[model samples]
Target: MKKENNLDKITRKEAISKMGKYAALTAIGTFVVLNPLKAAQSSTPPDDTGGNPFD
Candidate 1:
């Protein structure tokens, strides 16, 4: 039989943190894969900051 090592153990908080990281990556990957065109578009919003100064 093999011996268990304490160093191999992870706390619940650490596990949750790791899971969160993976979840975020998965979500981003899914978004990019499903919406490649959208993802490639510019993040900046259009110049719709209200009525024109001249108007």
Candidate 2:
């Protein structure tokens, strides 16, 4: 009687797929870390007096 472990078995297709996914994730992470987006800053907001001009 012989016992085989399925967890130790990996196909070539699966390995390539996993490698590609990891590569894509790494690239995206690198890009985000290197060049981050900055939020727009406003110096001052418009004033609202709430007064009617016809009054």
Candidate 3:
């Protein structure tokens, strides 16, 4: 059996803080990359083909 060490353990608060930081960074990165594309795409109207409902 292996021995457990206190140094290897992480508290709940620390884990939550780390996760929050990662989530925030991911959100910011996604927004930075996609925001411009979204704005550009939004300017164009979507195709509204009133085609046959049952094709």
Candidate 4:
């Protein structure tokens, strides 16, 4: 079996901080990819969807 790295272990607080950073990064990535369309939409009034998305 291979040995684990003792040098790279993180504390619980560090892990939690890293989780928050990752979540924020993911949110920022999604927003960046979606921002162009959102900006355009915000510049215009929304059209009626016939009261239903399936309509």
lDDT of 3 by residue, 1-55 (tens): 9888999789999999999999999999999999999999889776878897689
lDDT of 1 by residue, 1-55 (tens): 9888999899999999999999999999998787967755846667887887897
lDDT of 2 by residue, 1-55 (tens): 9999999999999999999999999999988876643222434556978998689
In model 4, which regions exceed 4 Å deviation? 1-5, 40-55
The TM-score that candidate 2 achieves is 0.55
lDDT over C-alpha atoms for residue 10 of model 1: 98
* Top candidate (TM-score): 3
Question: What's the true lDDT of residue 6 in model 4?
Answer: 85
Instruction: Name the best candidate (by lDDT).
Output: 3
Reference-based lDDT, each prediction: 0.88, 0.81, 0.94, 0.92
Ranking by TM-score: 3, 1, 2, 4
TM-score of each: 0.58, 0.55, 0.65, 0.53
Q: Which digits, one per residue and each the tens of the lDDT, describe model 4 over residues 1-55?
A: 9999988999999999999999999999999999998898889677876676775
Better of 1 and 2 by lDDT: 1
